[model samples]
Target: MTSRPLRVMECAAGTPGFGAQTGLMAEQNKNIETWRRRLTFRSWHRGTKELDLLFGPFADARLADYDAPALAQYEDLLMAPDPDVYGWIVGFEPPDPAYDTLVLRDVIAFQRTRHA
Candidate 1:
């Protein structure tokens, strides 16, 4: 049995392997920023004014603080129909099991605190 040495690559700027590693990192960051911007815009423009008001402010206040999983949850919530999502958030109706998430709870809490 032969043991091969593990190569630890330095990805810092101006270091070896920097260009490729940093380029990938930069691309990932750009994609995340693009998704965040798109979600924020969508939140502010949900067909009805009610939804716009409910989600727009939430997106603005919290989107930047969300990690990858949280961001994915938000993106899933946005994919739902506005009326359904709004109903769930406002407690007018129950969310489907899949739509029920911490992200939705956070939104509900946000709206409650924001309007209270």
Candidate 2:
């Protein structure tokens, strides 16, 4: 079996300027490109399971802008546990102020496991 490294980014809406923020983050983080394929766009209106999985065990912030169906799909992706895939979701703060956006980024890296 192999282990993978993954990275995910979650962006909120109404943050003064969203596109710019994304661009800036992308520029600074070289790993962002590797995980772009696994990006998931979610809305606050959707379920929390997907968000929970991405955010890890300690994600308590509320989402204020998201679509229901989109979130469901995202949740499904997160629940998938494959040794070849490892990922995490970034979280936004001040949930109320942000609306019309919920970005979920995920990355997947693979490493072979050795047997004794």
Candidate 3:
């Protein structure tokens, strides 16, 4: 499939508050799966956040199985048309070691352009 720029908007950041760890893990996993779906040219928006959680580990596991072309295809998707897919990509403050919590830092709005 033709590559396009994706615009990722991180709506929120990971905090040390309640369910923060779980939430960060979920987000990380979900983001990974979202990457897989995007690379495979699947309609990610059609599914729910649960889909994101389910596909996260699956995508990570499949990474080692992907060939060079496939990996390149995935990277291409990240940089295409816009880096943000209606707020798919997110940013948070860095996790704090003292709190034993993951704090997403530098959560900002940005644009990434991918080439074929």
lDDT per residue for candidate 1 within 36-90, as digits (tens), equals: 9999999999788998999999999999988778999998998898778978999
Clashes of 1: 0
Query: Could you give the C-alpha RMSD of every candidate to the true structure, in order shown?
Result: 4.2, 18.8, 20.4
> What tens-digit string does per-residue lDDT give for candidate 2 at 47-99?
55553353432222322222345444445544444221132322222222222
- Looking at model 2, report the run of 10 residues with the lowest lDDT sum: 107-116
- Between prediction 1 and prediction 2, the one with superior lDDT is 1
Clashes of each: 0, 6, 26
Better of 1 and 3 by TM-score: 1
lDDT tens digits, residues 1-116, model 3?
A: 99776523232234335444466677876766665556544323324453333223334445545544555544543343332322333322322333221111101111121111
Model 3: which ten-residue window has the lowest total lDDT? Answer: 101-110
Q: Which regions of candidate 3 fall more than 4 Å away from where they truly are?
A: 1-21, 42-116
